[model samples]
Target chain A: MMNPKGTQPEDLVWECQACHVNLVEGPVTLMYMGNRITVDLPQCPRCGFVLVSEAVALGKMAEVEQALEDK
Target chain B: MTAFTARALSHVPHVLRGITGNTLRPGGLALTERAADWCAFQPGARVLDIGCGLGATLMYLRDIRGCRACGLAISAQMLSECRGMPVLQAAGDILPFYDKCLDGIFCECVVSLLVEPPKAFREFCRVLRPAGWLVLTDVYLRNPQSGAGDLAASATCLSGASDNTELMKHLNDCGFDVILWEDHSRYLTELAARMVWTLGSRELLMQLLFPGGCSAENKQNMQGASPGYGLWIARLKGPKR
Candidate 1:
């Protein structure tokens, strides 16, 4: 998680908003966000989730909380 | 075309010497900087540079980072030119090294042209130690729209960047953790224009260099219209064992 020499996060981080996984957990010269203000996210090391976006995480969080209450 | 490619690679050393004061092309130096800037290479780390044309990038790493480096190239003629330097003539797919022995792997503009990039990727992974860095800077397809024909037309032992997604998939499949990839389309477009202009303006010389290509003007026009280049940097994953 240390910054590689001669680089700093210019704008946003390469992090998954869902499981909070970092695709590239270190410094990068350039980061590509395919469309919109996007962040590059890695698959969850523990959960094996894919295509985890911020919107998806918010929706999932509500489902989890409601499920816990039901239990 | 194979003959042309062989001759072209032979001439690269001379051409590169002229362009760079350090006896390598600007692109080679750029790749060196890319690796050093991105990877935290410890002093005296063993480095392997796949397709180390003219050994310029390796020299840069030695000079800048004080890392012990070696180079491998396919062209014996090119390798012969690297005599007295730390380089060997070798294939990217079948590297001459033991498993998990190197601290880093540097491949600049080499993998895209391979008949089997996965093989090359696996070889790189095989040679790299745990968490070893894999830094690459090469041409890649920018427009996914340009399908097989475009790839076939441009395919060479030197370059055959079909598409970005496919390129990434191959790296991932080869067990490399993709750290960075970028489309350097604009830069390559501009570079192509420069090459075309440089060769096309000199009719006799252009013919001499590119032999069977169209007329100088036509060649220039064709090179001008192509899609651009790309770059990638990845990390070699540790072996399964």
Candidate 2:
């Protein structure tokens, strides 16, 4: 239950943006893939949307933040 | 010589998983839930729980992930214990499923019980789809020498522990790419102590259930006691086709 220190790879619980179902399981490692795009090797369990890798998810915080702000 | 069947101890996990969540004996529900939640099961994912004793973890998965879940076990008695739930009788060494059938596969404290862990890992690999996730929590070796005494010991509830290196090797050879592997030794060691002490206090009852001296004291007195166990997450490699 410890919060991640900004640069640390945070173990997060995310929902599918399209379906709103929680993506509660899988390994998401944080890596720099040039501007940080979340690479979901495994797709969403319900909708088959590619679930992003942990690294990508952590790296793409700005995009996720923007998307969240937009919503 | 005493033999233990999965059915005989089926209710143990049923009651324990409800209490502990992770099904590794008497750990608190918080640790158990944290273990289960750590798998990060995707919503509506196809998950197969091998040796889904008592269906407790499966229940957790169903409730949390809303995923389609199925189970396989060798003990009809244990399978019966899971009655009215989505479970099938099968063994870990040879799971009764087709290739790439599951997105996530989980096992709890049951791997070391397998007579052939390599075969079991192969079976796990066979059933998982490419990049499919695997979540496992079982006993491991903290100090390599601690496992030596049990190698030749007769089968008991705790008879099937594998060292950390062997476990990792089997998973890797079976085509799984390791992700997160943790040495939950302190937890297992603590459980081993508590398991012996608490179960010893209930020797008469366990004798009634097992009938042939599978009590906590008997297991504790044995030379091959393990102090460390592990939890691992790996991915099945993509299909050849």
The residue-by-residue lDDT of candidate 1 on B1-241, one tens digit each, is 1221121243553332433434333243655676677888877999988787767777777877888989887777667766566987667888889999999988776766566777778888888888888887766544445332323333232236556788789889988888877665544433332233223223433343344544545443434334446667788765587
lDDT of 2 by residue, B1-241 (tens): 1232332233453323332444434243333366557666667888887877667767777876687888777767667867667887655666667888888887777776776777778878887888888877776545556334433243334456567787888888889888888765545433333332223333332343244445344444333444355778888876567
Candidate 1 lDDT score at position B167? 76
Model 1 TM-score (2 dp): 0.63
How high is the lDDT of residue B215 in model 2?
36
Write down the lDDT that model 2 would get: 0.59
DockQ comparisons of all candidates to the true complex = 0.01, 0.01
Backbone N/Cα/C clashes per model = 0, 13
- Candidate 2 share of real interface contacts: 0.00
Candidate 1 retains true contacts at a fraction of 0.00
List of clashing residue pairs for candidate 1: none
Model 2 residue B101 lDDT score: 82
After TM-score superposition, what is the CA distance of residue B203 in candidate 2 from its true location, in Å?
A: 10
